[model samples]
Target: MSRIGKKPVSLPSGVTASVDGQTVRAKGPKGELTYVVNDEVLVQLGDDGIKVDPRDTSKDARAKWGMSRTMISNILTGVKDGFEKRLEITGVGYRASMQGSKLQLALGFSHDVLYDVPEGIQISVPKPTEIVIVGIDKQRVGQVAAEIREYRGPEPYKGKGVRYAGEKIVRKEGKKK
Candidate 1:
């Protein structure tokens, strides 16, 4: 019943995918990634591409069907082209820099925040106010970006602090007489 699950995930060029029981593995120019499909979902590697379906008619099964399919699709794309996340730092004296494997952030705090970079992920600062994170695993890439943003989340008042690129913050009006 899920439209996204109904459509097979087509294999892109230079990407090879395989299914082993409930696990799906994909290898491409970028790297290799694997995803374990939920038991409520049925996954198969067909000639057309990867096919996902609900194992049962239960609501739980149906809910997992689309999520399992998307996970497989993410692994395929991640191995083929990798993933990138950009963060923008906004505030007075707020900036980011790379100190070897650690990311140094100065967000108006008395002490600078140093975040240790995780394995299989690369972080860079093209500009003082810009941070770039790259990795072959989509989930890890996104998680890293989120952790960085959490350090100094953007406030609605002045929208100051770290934020995702192009993210729209609903600014709130300040107290007035």
Candidate 2:
């Protein structure tokens, strides 16, 4: 049995959730989100909260049960409080800035790279070396951060590049003369 699936997703204050067939919808002050559960999993809203269970004892059903539960939980949290991701740029001449709806990046490249911010997501630069992304959908916030990081990922040798905030890079030894 999946421990995560066994626990019901408690609704945060100011949040409401409803189940329609295999689709679950959550609405809150932040925003609204919907998730379609797999057929192998069963979802129901009860007094305590939303409950998830495997439709059968098959491997696929068990695997999807936990994932479906987590997805429901994420939507609830997203609609209530939202999600955020932060990135830090470390290197000489490496920085980030906002140009209207685009994110301007100077990651040692010859020309500055411009990333068009997607809808439903907000990007802010508190400092030249810091970038903050906010969105109601947790997956979209993480995906935007990952795409930005991929532009100038940290190198093992000097660990100079863009990385997630609080991320640790395993530094490699410099060349021995």
Give the TM-scores of the predictions, in the order they appear: 0.97, 0.99
lDDT of each: 0.94, 0.95
Which candidate ranks first by lDDT, i.e. highest? 2
Encode model 2's per-residue lDDT on 104-123: one tens digit a residue: 99999999999999999999
Clash pairs of candidate 1? none
Which segments of model 1 are wrong by more than 4 Å? none
* Clash pairs detected, candidate 2: none
For model 2, the local distance difference test gives 0.95
In candidate 2, where is summed lDDT lowest over 10 consecutive residues? 73-82
| Residue 25 displacement in candidate 1 (angstroms) | 0.7
Residue 158 of model 2: what lDDT? 87
- Deviation of model 1 at 105, angstroms: 0.2
